[model samples]
Target: MKVAIASDGGNVAQHFGKCQEYAVFDVVDGRSENFSYIPNPGHQPGFLPKYLKGLNVDCIIAGGMGQKALNLFAENNIQPIVGISGEVKQVMEDYINGKLTSGASLCTHPDGQHHDCDGHC
Candidate 1:
């Protein structure tokens, strides 16, 4: 399976749409195989979901994502795991080891302003 973690530098970005890049990791037999970073294509409505789907992304891991993007990902048959933070490598490892859990973080807007994001993830 392939997992995409919305990231900035190496950490999971606070908000999915405003994230700088994506760390795409491939896993097989429940073990991670490899990873690559991809720049954010753009944050226009449903564009990202489609773009990621084209890359055959199976799941998305992020700190937060609004309702629209989550719905689009669902529509595209891509599972989304939100409320994740910390560096991408650790997050991925935790997930692979079945230690990561989704928190209650949800971004209502792309700007990441005027929203309560602190510790929400």
Candidate 2:
């Protein structure tokens, strides 16, 4: 599976929309295949989903994200795991070892728009 971890420096980004980059890791049979850090292609509404989808990402791990972003991932069948923090490599290891479990969002949307919360888009 291909997992994308929202990153800021070396830790998990505080917010998905505001993340500086995404560390794309490819795992096959529980073994890492390749990894790369790609700068975010901008988070314009409805655009990032398409961009990420095109990259063939199967999952997205982040600290928090807007409901719309969650919906976007849902539409693409990409699992969205939020409320994650810590080193990117460790997070991936936890995930691979089945020790990683998601929790509620840790950050809030700054725009205060309709796409704010509600857990739905």
Candidate 3:
């Protein structure tokens, strides 16, 4: 499976749409391999899910995600795992070990406006 983690400066970005890039890993038999980074193309409504899907990403990990994005990912057959935080390497380890699980969305946009949260989300 291919997993992508929304990242900024080697850590998980708070908001997936606003992230600087993605840390992508190809996993086989519960082992992560062939890591790479993909720059964020830009954040437009319903764009990212399609973009990652095009790249054959099977799953996405992020600190937060909007409701619409979550739905879009589902439609694209990409698993969206949100409410994650911390460094990318550590997060990857947890995911490979089956210790990672999603929690509540950290997104604070009730009105659906994309605003900078200064990495606090």
Clashing pairs in 1: none
Looking at candidate 2, the ten consecutive residues that score lowest on lDDT are 112-121
Residues 13-83 of candidate 1: C-alpha lDDT, one tens digit per residue: 87787789999989888888878999998776678889999999999999887766778999999988988
Query: How does candidate 3 score on lDDT?
Result: 0.89
Pairs with backbone N, CA or C atoms under 3 Å apart (clashes), candidate 3: none
Q: In model 3, where do residues sit more than 4 Å from their true spots? A: 109-114, 117-121
TM-scores for all candidates? 0.85, 0.87, 0.90
Candidate 1: stretches off by over 4 Å:
106-121
> Which structure among the candidates has the greatest TM-score?
3
Give, for candidate 3, the lowest lDDT window spanning 10 residues.
112-121
lDDT of 2 by residue, 1-121 (tens): 8999989998999777678999999888987778999998876777766788899999889998777788888899899999899999999999888888889877665565535434322
Better of 2 and 3 by TM-score: 3
Model 3 lDDT, residue 52, Cα: 98
Model 3 residue 72 CA deviation (Å) reads 0.3
